[model samples]
Target: MTDATIKTAAMLAIGDELLSGRTKDKNIGHLAEVLTMAGIDLKQVRIVGDEEEAIVEALDALRERYDYVFTSGGIGPTHDDITADAVSKAFGVPCLHDPDAMGLLSEMYQRRDMEFTDARQRMARMPQGSRHIANPVSTAPGFVIGNVYVMAGVPQVFQAMLDTVVATLPAGTRILSRSLPCPFGEGDIGTLLGAVQKAHPETSIGSYPHFDGKRFSTELVVRGRDARALDAAAHDVAAMIEALTMEREGAKSKDLGTGELA
Candidate 1:
C-alpha cells in the first residue's frame, strides 16, 4: 500500500430473500473489514431483489462510482437466477457458458457420478469477456468482468471468492483505527469533539455511545492512513475525554482541578 492512491469499492447483495426478510445478510461486514485490511476502502453496500433491471441499474451506478464492485447472489441453478444476465446487459455483452467454468463443473459432477443437468450447468454461465473467480468450496466458479466481480450469495462461498479476488485488486493506504472508551457522553463532549475534528482534518473521528441502566459512556474512534497524524489525533481525543471526565467528577469529588482543554 506504499505510495498508492486510495482505492474504493462497493458491495451489492442481490436476492429477493434478503429484501423479503427471509434471510439475514452477513457478507457486507465481512467484505468491508476484509477490504479495509487489504487497504481498499469499502464505501457503500446496497441490497436489491433478484430482478434483472434492478441489478443492472445498481451495477451501472456502482461501477461508475467506485474502483471495484462486488456482487453476491443470483448466479445459481434456479430459474429466477439472473445476475450474470443482468451484468452482461450492463456491460453490453452476451451471456454465455464459460468453457473453463464448464470444465470445472463437469469434472466435479463426473467425479461424483452425478448427471450434469442443464440446471446445474447454469452455474457456468458468465458474461462474455469475463474471467473466472476460483471457488474452492464449490467447483462452479464466479466471474469478474471489468471492475465488477459476481460471486455466490452463500457466506462460505462468498468468503472464498473474496480471498481469490484480493490479490487482483489495487492497494491503497492502510487505514488505522484507535479507540478510547470514555465516561463522557455525547452531550458532554459534542463541542470538544467538533473542535478535535477541526484540529485533525486529515483523520476521521466518530463517537459511539452506549447506555443501559446507570452510566452514559462513549467510544471515540479515530482513523487515518498516516500513523503519525493518527497518533497525534488519538492522543488529543484521549486527553479530551480525560479532561471532561475529571470535570464531571470534580463537581462531586473534592479538590479536582479543571483538566486540560481539548
Candidate 2:
C-alpha cells in the first residue's frame, strides 16, 4: 500500500427507527471497517430521522466537509422513504425515475411474477446525474451522486452495495496496527502510555480495558501508516507495561516484608 494522503469520509444514517431505538444499526460498524481497510478515514457519522429537512441539512454539511459521504436508509417503497428527494434537494438537482434503475427493478419483478407496482416503482427514483450502485442481494439499487453514495438500510444489501462502492473509491495509505496485551489496567499505565504517545507523534496509541472476571487488564493498540513508527511505539508500550508490572511487584514485596497488606 502507498503512504499517500489519507482520504476522508463521513456517514449519514437516516431513519426515525434508528433514533427511536426501534431498529438497531449494523451498517455503521461495517462501513467503518471497510473504509479503514480501503484507507479512507471515516471521520464522522451522523444519524438523522426520516425527516427530509434533517436529512438534507446533514447531507449537505457532510458532503461539503468530507471527501465522500455515505448515506443509508429512507430509499424504500414506503411513503416516508424520502432519501432520494432529500438528496436531490441537497444538490439542487431534479429527482426523477432513473431509467437504468427502473429497467433493473422491472426485470427482477417480472422474473418473480410480481407486478412493478407504483409503490415498488418508488425504488427506481433517484437524483439526476446519479450513478447506480448495483445490489447483489436485492433487486433495488443504490445510487451515487457527486461525492455522496446513497445505499440501502438493510444489513445484507448495504454490505453488498459497499463491496461494489469501495472498489470504485481511491485507496489511500492503509493504516497498520499492532496490539499488545498488558497485564496492567489503564490507571496503572495511563501516565506512561501518554508519554510514549507523545514521544511517537507518528503513531496513535490507544488503551482499551477489559475485565477477565477477576481483574481489569488493558490492550494497547498502536496504529500508524508507517510500519517503523508503529513498531517503535508498540515496543515502547510493551516496555512501559513491563516496568509498571515490576514496580507493582516490588511494592507488594516491600509491603509483605513489613507485614502490611499489599
State which candidate has the highest lDDT: 2
TM-score of each: 0.93, 0.94
Q: What are the C-alpha RMSDs, in order, of all predicted structures?
A: 4.2, 2.4
- Candidate 2 local lDDT, 1-262, one digit each (tens): 2233778899999999999999999999999999989989998999999999999999989999889999999999999999999999999999999998999999999999999999999999999999999988888999999999999999999999999999998788888999999988888888889999999999988899999887889889999989999989988888888888899899888778577543
- The positional error of residue 127 in candidate 1, measured at the CA in angstroms, is 0.5
- For model 2, which pairs clash? none
lDDT of 2 at 79: 98
For candidate 2, the 10 contiguous residues with the lowest summed lDDT are 1-10
* Model 1: how far residue 23 lies from native, Å: 0.8
lDDT of 1 by residue, 95-213 (tens): 99999888999999999999999999999999999999999998789999999999999999999999989977766768999988888778989999999999998899999999967
Which run of 10 residues does model 1 get worst, by summed lDDT?
253-262
lDDT of each: 0.90, 0.92
